[model samples]
Target: MERVPLSEVVSDCVRRWFQDSLKEAKAGDVAMQVLVGQMYHSGYGVARSEQKGRAWFEKASRYRSSVWKVSNKRPGLNASDSDSDEVKENIK
Candidate 1:
C-alpha cells in the first residue's frame, strides 16, 4: 500500500474548503463571499487568483446594507426578512 503525500492531502483539504465556500457564496451568503474573496487574494485555501478575488469582493460589497436599512432589509437566520408582528403594527 502506498501513502498519499502530506502536501497532497493538505491541498485536497484546502481545495474542498474553497469549493464549499464557493457554494455558499453563490447562494447569497455575504460573509462567505467575502471569505472566498480573501482566500483567493491571500492564496489561503486555493491558488492566488486576484481577479476572482476582486470579483467576489465586488459581489459582497453589493450585498452590504446601510445601517438604517438593516432593520427593514436584513434577513433573519432562516434567510427570511419578514417583518415581525410588532414591526407590522408599529407606533406602539
Candidate 2:
C-alpha cells in the first residue's frame, strides 16, 4: 500500500468528511468534529450531509462548552468583541 503524508491526509480529510473516518474520531475531538460538521453543513469539504452535519455541529458545540472556560476570548480562536457570552449575557 502507498503511504500518504500526514499533511495530505489532513487536507483530504478537510476536503471531505467521510462518514467512516468521522466515526473513528470521537465527538470529544472538537476541532476535527467541527470540521466534519462544517463539511456537511456548508458542503465545504463534503456533500450537503445535513443530518451528519447537524449531529456533528451539536456535538462540537456541546463539547466546546464542556472543555472551555468562560475566560476572555482570544483573537486566534476567532473570538470577536461581540462573541463573548459573558458580555452578551451581561448586556441582557
Candidate 3:
C-alpha cells in the first residue's frame, strides 16, 4: 500500500472541483461561472489570467439577478475597479 501526502490529495480535490465548475459554467450556470472566474483569478486549479477571469465575471454578472452573493474576494488576485463594482452590485 502507498500513501499520498495530504497536500497532494487536497490539490487533486481542488482541481476536480474547479473542473466541475468549469463544466457547469460552460452549461450557463451563472453561479458556477462566477466560481470559475474566482478560480481563474486565484489560480486555484488553473493558471491565473485576469483577462479570462474578468470575461467570466462579466458573463456571470449578466445573470446577476439569478446568482447569489458569495464572497467579495479572490484569494490570490487583486480586485480591479470593475471587479469591485461587480461585487458591489452582486451584493446589492
Best-matching candidate per lDDT: 3
Off by over 4 Å in 3: 65-72, 75-92
* Pairs of residues clashing in candidate 1: none
Stretches of candidate 1 exceeding 4 Å from the true structure: 65-92
Higher-scoring candidate on TM-score, 1 or 3: 3
The lDDT for every candidate, in the order shown, is: 0.65, 0.54, 0.71
Residue 22 C-alpha lDDT in model 1: 90
> What are the per-residue Cα lDDT tens digits for candidate 1 across 48-83?
887887787677767653211222221221112223
- Ranking of all candidate structures by their lDDT, best first: 3, 1, 2
**What TM-score, computed on C-alpha atoms, does each candidate reach?**
0.61, 0.44, 0.72
After TM-score superposition, the amount by which residue 22's alpha carbon in candidate 1 deviates from its true location, in angstroms, is 0.5
| Model 2 CA deviation exceeding 4 Å by range | 1-24, 66-92
Q: lDDT for model 1, please.
A: 0.65
Score residue 82 of candidate 1 by CA lDDT: 28
Candidate 3 residue pairs that clash: none
